[model samples]
Every structure is written in C-alpha cells, then in structure tokens.
Target: MSDDQLFALANALPLVGWLALCLAPLARPALVASARVVAAAMAVGYAVMVGLALARAGGPAPDLTTLSGLARAFSDPHVMLVGWVHYLALDLWTGAWEAEDAGRRGVPHWLLLPCLALTFLAGPIGLLLFLGVRTLPGRRVPARP
Candidate 1:
C-alpha cells in the first residue's frame, strides 16, 4: 500500500482500541475483554508505524533539538503518521491509567465515559480535564482518636 493508505490504516488502528476502551470497566462488564486492546495496539501498531516512517529517506536524520527541528523530522508523510501513532499510544496509556484511577476513586461512569472519550480524541485536553475532575472533594474518612 502507498504511504497515504498506510497512514490511514495507522490512524484507524487506534480508534478501534479507543472504542473498546469506551466500554471500560468503569462503564460495563466487558472491560476485561478489552483490557488487552490498548497494550497490544501499542506493541504492534507502534512498531508498524515507526517501521514505515523509517522506511522513508532521511526521515530520522533531523536534529530534533527544537520544535521546528521536530517538525522537519516529521515532514515525511510516513514519519508524520508515526508521530501521530506515538501520540495515540501515549494518550491511550494515559486514558487507561485515568480509568483505573477513576474506578478506584469512585468517579461515576457518566463522568468517566466523557473523559475517556475526550482523552482518546485529544491527548492533553482529556488528561487536564480528568485532573481537574479529580480535585473535587471526596468524603473524608474519620481518624482514630
């Protein structure tokens, strides 16, 4: 397949895992079934995307010491797609952690679902939103006298 097609495929792979995560333990009983999805995606999907990116000429030779340098490094379509998948893996991992932490803290499904969805869509925004939600005061346990 052409690099454009490969890029499209790379983008689609994470959506499947993110959708699976939407049915996370916090929201349903099928959580266990999808638990492996993100990790597997990270392992397989990331490798494939990175490999494709490296296939391009000079794709990995950028200085990468500054923002523009990083941008130039990823100017190649394949490398750009690899960069996207890199975000996907990091975002999904963070979303997974957020789900587990929210579950432990008794955050409601109504809230968690949106947060997870947002995280899947925009990595930093969702994490920031969830962190804000986490600041809501919870019932305090009494101290022993």
Candidate 2:
C-alpha cells in the first residue's frame, strides 16, 4: 500500500475500534465477538507498522504511492506520532480487554480504570502509572517456599 493509504488506515483503526465497542451494547454476542476480533487484528497490524518505522530509522522512507514504497518512509516525528497513537489505542483496547477479563476473574474494576485512562492519553504513562500504583510503601514480605 502507498504511504497515504497506510497512514489513513492507521488513523482509522482507533475510530473503527471505538465505533465497534460503542455499538456492542446493541449487537448480538457473535457480532460483538467479530468486532473484537477485528479490533485485535487492527491493533496487531498497527504494532507491525510501528516496528517497520523503527527499522526504517529516519532515512529515505517509502513513497506510499506504491505498495513496495510503503516501507521507505523515513523515521520522522509525524510518522512516529501516528505510530504512537496507534500504540496508545491498542494499549487502551488491551487495557479494556483486561478490565473485562479481570471482572470475569473477580478482580476489582477500580484497579483497571485509572490505568485505562492513563494509557488512553499516553501509552507509556499507563504502564508507569500501573507500576507506580502497584509498588506498595509497606515492607516487602518474604517469599514463601
């Protein structure tokens, strides 16, 4: 795919995922499942694109006008930010999934909410926040054998 097409697709992912999630309440279980699968696939594709950008490293990048030229785009802030947003969206979606999973597992919902918000705003910050929240001030207990 061309650069423009790739960028457009990358940009569309979060919107598409959000739309599906938003519509899920009225959809059948199978429909919701299909939405989730599409969201997950989009997230994975976003990640692979990120890896490709890192590999390119700010050199003469792809033209995006041609399928073969898509990987040729240089590593620039614009591209990086687009990739970052994709990462954030994926990260948030994963957090949402985890929150649902945690509910199924009987973990508290409160624990997941803040992390989700943090990641939604900025991907790395959510992880940092989670780690910060997880670290207790109390003394560490000895490991049980």
Best by lDDT: 1
Residue 46 displacement in candidate 2 (angstroms): 3.0
lDDT of 1 by residue, 61-109 (tens): 7778999988877786666776776777788777777776666666765
> After superposition, which runs of candidate 1 have C-alpha atoms over 4 Å from their true positions?
25-36, 51-60, 139-145
Q: What is the lDDT of residue 54 in candidate 1?
A: 60
TM-score of each: 0.75, 0.43
Q: lDDT per model, in order?
A: 0.69, 0.56
Q: What is the lDDT of candidate 2?
A: 0.56
Those runs of model 2 whose alpha carbons end farther than 4 Å from true positions after fitting are 54-82, 88-92, 95-145
lDDT string, candidate 2, 1-145, tens digits:
7667766776666555544433443443443455466667766776777787668666554587975555444255557555665674566465445444433343334665576567656667876775555453542334446
